[model samples]
Each structure stands twice: as C-alpha cells, then as structure tokens.
Target: MTNRSTAIPQLSWSDVCGRRLDRHGLSAPVRDGTPADAVAAMCGAHAQVLSAAEVSIGLRVAGATRADVADALWRERSLVKTFGPRGTVHLLPTRELPLWTGALSAIPPSSTTMPADARLTPDQTDEVIAAVAAALADAELTIDELSTEVVARTSPWAADPVVPAFGGRWPRWRQAMHLAAHRGALCFGPNRGRKVTYTSPRRWLPGLQPAPAADALAGLVRRYLHAYGPATPQQFAQWLSAPRRWATELFDSLASELEEVEVDGSPAWVRAGDTEPPPTPPHGVQLLPYFDAYTVGCHPRNRLFPGPAAQRALAGGQAGNFPVLLIDGTVAGVWHQRRSRRSLDVTVEPLTPLTVAERRELDDRVERLGQILEEKPQLTIGTVLVGGHA
Candidate 1:
C-alpha cells in the first residue's frame, strides 16, 4: 500500500516510545538473534525511542554492573560526537556518528553549560589538534589518555592544575576530536578498559565516505519520521536544535515521502508506508526512568498524564531525571525507592485517589519494578492526592 489507511491509533506516549526503542536497536539486547549488521540500524521505523533513552536515561540498561552499563552506553557514541545531536550530548551508537556529526556541521552551536574557564581560543584549539593527532597517529586511547596528551601539549603559561581534574583544557581537546570527526580523521575503535576508544574515522570506515550535507540532513529528517513518526516539524526542529530555515528545508526536501495524519486534532506526519501496526503492550505498571522518552518526546503533555497532575509529578521538569510511576498508560504519579537494612522502601504519590482495586494492582506493579531492580519493594502510598507534590 502506498499509504496507511488505518485510523490513527491512540498510542500512549509510553507505549509508542517503547516501540521506538525496540525498532532502533537502542533497546538493551545488542543482538536479537539477527546477524550483526555492519553498523546497527540507527535510522529505523522507530528511531525516536532510541534517542529518547540515549539522551535521557542513557543507552545502557540491563548489565549486572555499573561499568558494564556505562560501557554499553559509551559504545553508542564517543563522548564528543554525542553532543552534536540536539546540540546536547546523547549516548549515540558508534556506527551512527556520521548521521549526527554530519548534521551538527550544518547547525550553529547554541548556548550551553560548558565550563567557562575551560573555553579555548582558536590557536589553542589548533595546539590541541596537533597534540591529539600525534598521540593517536596509530594508537587508540581512552578519554583519560587523550586528556593527558592535551594537558602536556598545552603551554606551561596556559597550564592550570585544575585542568586535569575539571578538564579546564579538555574542551579544546574535544573540539579537536570533533574536527577530526568532521574530516573523517577519527572514528569508533575497540573499547579500552571500559571506555569506547577512538581512532581515525578514515581508518575505521575506509570506503564509507559520508553523503553530501544536503543528503545527510534529508536522511536525518526521514529517519526521525520513521522512528518517531506522526510528529510536527516544530518537534523535529527542537529535537535537532536546528535553525528554522534548515528545519524547513529538510522537511520540504521530503515533501513527497511522508504521510500526513491528524493526531489528537493536531497535524502530524507519519512515515508513508509501514503496513504492520506496532504491537499493543500488556496492561501493567511501568516504572519509567526520569526523563523517559515517553514524557519528553511528545507535546501538550495532557494526552499522557491528564491535567496538572503531570506538572506535579514532573516537579518543574525535574522528573525527567528520576524514576516515575506509570499506571496503565499515563503517569498516574511519581515514585522513588531507597534501599535500607533488609528491603526496598518505595514512596508513591498517586495523582488521583485510587480505588481499592487500583491500589492493589499498583502495589503488584511496584513489586515487579522492585524485582527488576533486584529488591523487594515496601510501598509507602502518599496521603496527598493528584496535583500535589510529595
């Protein structure tokens, strides 16, 4: 079929997000019995789900140790290349660097929270480039090793003791790597002691020249629609942090390719042709990570959490970084757990007064969340109802 004829489905933001993660190869399992594709599929029918986790809760999820978790996230992107998308750092896959960095080169850098004293001058940036090039001519090193090279190469007058600890000089070094990335001089390498290593990109992908800038941007637009389809250009622009002109240009380029849909009475664009519908999630409670893609990717928030309850649960958008209680599809409230002498104490604030059945069901769900976290959850239900913070 040229276009999907089914009615636009009422997918809870959480369910839609979960689907995205599964399709984009961002979910925990690295391989799901499929042969390893050269670089895992970064652009897929459900790309938003991956970016949601990568940008918010981070890419690594189910490893037994923190190091393993961090390593899994690190493989998504070298720390430097990760910052290009959304102009915010993301745990991107190493194989997909070109998709993001290529887009970064087209957008202007916006204001961000990089340490001020760490800023570098143009000449100093050049020095960093020379230093790192010398260090990695044939060698692959972790961020620490690369930082040492940068500190040593910096002039003694420019030296600051805090440079090592605070990376006062590291931004310049990071900039050099970005330059190297742009020139295809740096790329993903084998992991060294838990950190994803980087060597010359040219060396890593010898024949894989990047597509032209216009084509690359177009690819990003297409990928976003496929992954997080039924979205607005405004949403796409915010996700990429692109200028309005560039955003419009990219969308215009794909005029013939996308399909229009009315979601909740708002205009959206979904991919032109995916015949199979996404599977429905089993009804249950889900403890979403703070800043879970489900909450952050969509707009008008009401569709997911209902009313002021969303605001209370979010606590000034701070909720993105913490664990939350998902009752059915919407965020019914917020929850946090603390481990004690023998069990896990989970504090729950329900957005609305729950019926006896709902409370019991929620308790059971919290128990499952505790199981995932490897602890027995002792739930403490809050006295306050919806729209009030605990």
Candidate 2:
C-alpha cells in the first residue's frame, strides 16, 4: 500500500547537501540556524552505509575515527556490505543493502572491474583451497607467504594460454584467503608485522557459511537506496556498477516502497513514507572532503552542486586538494584546509560573493569547525578570487 498524492517537493539540494555535511560534524553556519538534528528533520535522515574501503577512505580522509565507523557498521546506520561501485567497496546501512546489492548483482563484472588477482578455474579454486588447507593443517601462513605459495601452485594455471596471467594482483588470492579463513581451515596468528596470518577457519567466523548470493545481493541494494536514495536508477546503477536491466529489476522489486521524484529537474527515487524531511537552516557552510559519499552519493551529481563546479572539484582524485563549501543549501565553491603547528588554515573560493549575512554565517561556521578540530579558533579563511572578485 503506497500513496502518490503528495508531490514530493523540490527539496533545496543545497539544504540537503549542507545539512549532510554538518551532520557529520564538518561545518555549519555561525548564526542561530538549524543544527544538523533540525535539518535532518527537513530531508530524511541519511544512513552512512559503506560497502567499499573507499567509503571508509573518504571518511578517514575527512578525519573520522574508527568509533564513528563502528557506529554505522552492521546496523541501520551502515550495512557491512561489499560490491563494485566505482570498482571499490561501498558500505551501506543495513536497511538499504538488499536493493543496492541486488541491483549490483544484476550487473556483470568486466575484466577491469573484477579484482586483480582472481584467476581460478573451479577446479583450480578447489585445488587452491585444498592446497591452502594442506598448508594450514600444521602451520599458519601470513598473507604474503600464503600468496607466495599460492602463486607457486597456481603458476601452472596462470601460464595457461587461455588465462590472462592475473596470478599475483592480490584480489582473487585475497578472496581465496577470506574463504579459507571463513571455512575454519584458517585462523589469524597474532598480527604479523602489520598483516594478519591465517591458521584455519575455526579460528575466525567459526561455523559460519557464506550467506546465499541472492540474500547478499538483495541486502546490498536495500541498504544503498535507503542511505543514498532519492537517487535515480541510473545513479543506483552507477553506484552498484550494475546494468540498467538489473537496476530496473531491483527498482521494480522495491517499486511499492519507493517514490519517483524530481530532484533539481532530474528524476530520482526516494524512500516512500510520511517521514518528515530534515529541517531548513537560516544559513550554512560545510567543508566536505573529496569523494565524500555526500558529494558522490548523487547519481547525476548536479542536484546538490552545479555541474561545472562538481566536475571541477573532481578534476583531482585526492581529498586534501578539494574541500567543499556549502553555503545556504548549495555548493558555493571549494574551501581548502591547511594545517599549521597550532592552527588550521581554511580558504574559501566562493563561486559568488557572500552576502553580509552569509559572510558572518561563514565566520561562525569557521569558529565551530576550529573548536571541533581543537585548533586555534581563528579562521584565516577568505574567499578565492574569480574575475578579480573575492
């Protein structure tokens, strides 16, 4: 049972993006504006489900802690998930994992998208497992040693004319090691010089068999849309590295629970319900890291940022180079943050001049960010020059 009478309002992309930034405790306006909690009341609360190492990488790049990550894992806040989105891992919240993973499963993996070290015929994989089992029967092996032995045994296969010689890239072997570890045939010996060695499966997730494929895929999809929804099937497809056909199937599966809406004139799918959106703030400024899920979370990209600006921001893949500025509810431009001995320098390059109120609001945000950083409260922040205008 779903209702379509309510036309989903044109949510201010800026508002959603800015609030998202501050919710993560990045930056916010100086005035008596809405806090992240209030703004969460305007748009739906976003879940920080991560599937890839990249999601964590993005968070770490932004200075998040393991505690922050633990909060989102295996819960509604985050789904302990995995798949190829941007050819890396993505962590989605538990609630939304099913649909996104399902959509992702629908997409076939190309050679480029598949892990680098994945060269195993079923028989060869079996052989590798058997070899791994035999090797671990008496002693545990570190990833490096295990990988070395695996290469020796699998070298014959790697040399096959039909095979691509992807024996040592660390992808497939890692997958095999995880399987062996999961199978109780291996356990981790004390952390060996920054790497964990495996003993037998009984040593790790004892007695736990891998979940069914359908179950895993469905779970991934559900989490992705739940956390990053109000997105398009295309965006979902892109996020999952899935094909359009499979994405449609997953979307259709959740059709009753999803609503089609336009975000900034582009079609997007948002969770369906009467749940109130996050509240609006009088003024706002947020410093979002590069590849911040909040920034790349959208499919079309322009819904929250101007296309030109977003593209320019992504021109560089690194995070420290591009710090995003959210003013009001839209991306005003980029802010660059630098660290000094006792203070941090934040420089803003606004796409447009700030109004007197906006500037003051920005100053307050700078103060708050400094407090959070435990650095000097001084901003040392200024706007960038564009066409001789600051």
lDDT of prediction 2: 0.49
| Candidate 1: segments with Cα more than 4 A from true spot | 1-84, 87-89, 111-148, 151-212, 274-283, 315-319, 340-343, 355-368, 383-390
Q: Which candidate comes out best when scored by lDDT?
A: 1
Q: What's the lDDT for residue 258 in model 2?
A: 73
TM-score of model number 2: 0.59
Q: Give me the candidate number with maximum TM-score.
A: 1
Candidate 1's residue-wise lDDT over 1-390, tens digit each? 123455654444555545555553333434322211201333311122333233232222322222322445444232222334443333444455566557556665455465676666668766765676566668887877766766787764334433343534433456445654543445445667668676654443344355667777777777666656667777777766556665766676776676666554566676665323446552445555445544455444565567755666666543354445665546677766666775878788777787787788777656655544556778888743434222
lDDT string for model 2 (96-127, tens) is 33333333333454344443344555566566
TM-score per candidate, chains pooled:
0.63, 0.59
In model 2, where is the ten-residue run with the lowest total lDDT? 35-44
